[model samples]
Target: MRVLLVKLSSLGDVIHTLPALTDAWHAVPDIHFDWVVEEGFAEIPGWHPAVAHAIPAALRRWRRDWRSTRAERHAFRARLRAQRYDRVIDAQGLIKSALVARQAIGPRWGLDRASAREPLAAWTYRHRVRVPREQHAVSRTRALFAAALDYSIPNTVADYGLARERLPVPSTAPGDLLFLHGTTWPSKHWPEAYWCELMALAAADGLRVLLPWGDETEHARAERIAVAGAGHGFVLPRSGLGELAALIASARIVIGVDTGLAHLAAALGTPSVTLYGATRPDRTGTFGEAQIHLSARFPCSPCLTRECGYRGASVVRPACYEALDPARVWAQTRETMSGSREMAHGA
Candidate 1:
């Protein structure tokens, strides 16, 4: 069977969709699985051995320019239509994704709008599988396919096989923990002062700390953490996604906020403790991978709002993360790392 799985954009969402393939492939071992994904995230699907092809949907770059966009998109559409896939699964339930799946020369399938992350995206599917809304996003993807194909969903299987390059871990004993302190969205970030305290505590325990910064603001934030920790912190050179993955793979442990890199760390099977604020771990947390700590103390938690509102509030102000104490996070970090070591030793 030539199966086409459509999931594009947002690193976390793509990571969540990975496990579905394990069961899908098992259900159809002779299947040739090809994923339609954003160019930026295409590397992820390429890491999976079950995937026969990683079809790049350059939607991210498409909106930026017209000439190249039209040329590339036309070519991509032609190639996709030529495949005549046996089954096409729209894992990403968006209007654009549905349209893309329909463009494929195959019988189209997707989640019903009520079950879709984006409900409106469902109308475009030729067939919609109604799944439980409460299911975790990863499970939702797996269940959607299972429901459509009449195959049982398999137990969780986390496998991402990245090709090894010349990138190698340094020979020096790892004394420092990697702290990913920046996020694309401001609402998801933990308080800067809290990071300062965490870095200080980690360094005090004789662990060197390095913070990787992407932009100037993140660089400034790293500088602030370094100054607060009295030079125990330093920023790493700007890195591409693959390099960042390699770096996270080498770290003894990763301490981070709830963001893409943090999710990447968990998906890579590295020891990590991610801080959650407005988001619920159940919905999109590290799956079958690493330890996760969530702050559910706030009454308004799992608000699902990019911004929190206190009774009569409608803006994106998040107070849930602010209530998380540094000491509590530190304790969780230690426990997670200890558990990771035990798991490693088969104890």
Candidate 2:
């Protein structure tokens, strides 16, 4: 069976769909997938052996210059239509994703109106499957696949089904910690002071601290953190998703704010401590072996807001993060690392 999967953009969402592909592959051994993802994240789907093609959809880029990029968009659509897929699944139930699924050559399948994030997107699907919204994002996708493909949803843990060998292993020595501090939302940031303190704690424990950045703003923040560490920390050069994944795969431990890289670390099976400030862990938190989630304890926490609304001058920069002390995070990080090491030795 040939399938076309439409889950575009956002690194975390793309990673979340991998296990669903694994489930489908397990049910139908002859099944092959052709994933339509944001051009930036096209590398992800190919990491799974079940995926035969990773089609790049420049939707984000095309929207910026729709008139000028008409030819390119036409060419991509032509290429997509040329393939004869048996089914097209839109795991991402947004209007934009539904539109992408409609361009394919098979019966479109997606979440029903009652279960979709956007009710309007459900109308585009020829076959709509209702998946429970209360479950984690991973479980919802797995359930959607099971329902759409006429297979039973397994009662086991999620298997990301990515080959570790596809990513180049970093040369960094063992016991080195990688801090993924770059995130899209301001409210999700762990305080810079807390990061510095955590670096100092890791340095005292003889662990080398490495900070990875995405943009200019994150680069500057990473430099400041490195400077604050005085000699114990180093800022990594700007890296693509694959390079960063390689680094994460090699790191002894990853301590990160709620970001896609944190999710990538968890998916890579790296021991990690993910600090949550404004978001709740029950719905979208990173989940895997040795992955620890630490959520804030403030009343206004998990507000799911993009910006900090606390107005008190006496409060921390992001007051929600104040509840997560760096010392406590460090303690958890150490415990997770120790447990991972023991497991590795036992295996």
Best-performing candidate as measured by lDDT = 2
lDDT of 1 by residue, 155-273 (tens): 65655434445344443334347888888766677888888899888878767787888899998898889876676776777667767777787777888887788777776778888
| Residue pairs whose backbone atoms clash in candidate 1 | 176-208, 307-316
Per-residue accuracy of model 2 over 7-100 as CA lDDT, tens digit each: 9978888888888998998998799999999999988887899999999999878999999999999998897899778899999999999988
Candidate 2 — what's its lDDT?
0.87
Which stretches of model 1 miss by more than 4 angstroms?
156-176, 310-317
The model with the greatest TM-score is 2
TM-scores for every candidate against the unseen true structure? 0.89, 0.97
Q: What is the C-alpha lDDT of each candidate?
A: 0.77, 0.87
Model 2 TM-score on a 0 to 1 scale: 0.97
Where is model 2 more than 4 Å wrong at Cα?
169-175
Q: Which ten residues in a row have the lowest lDDT in candidate 2?
A: 167-176
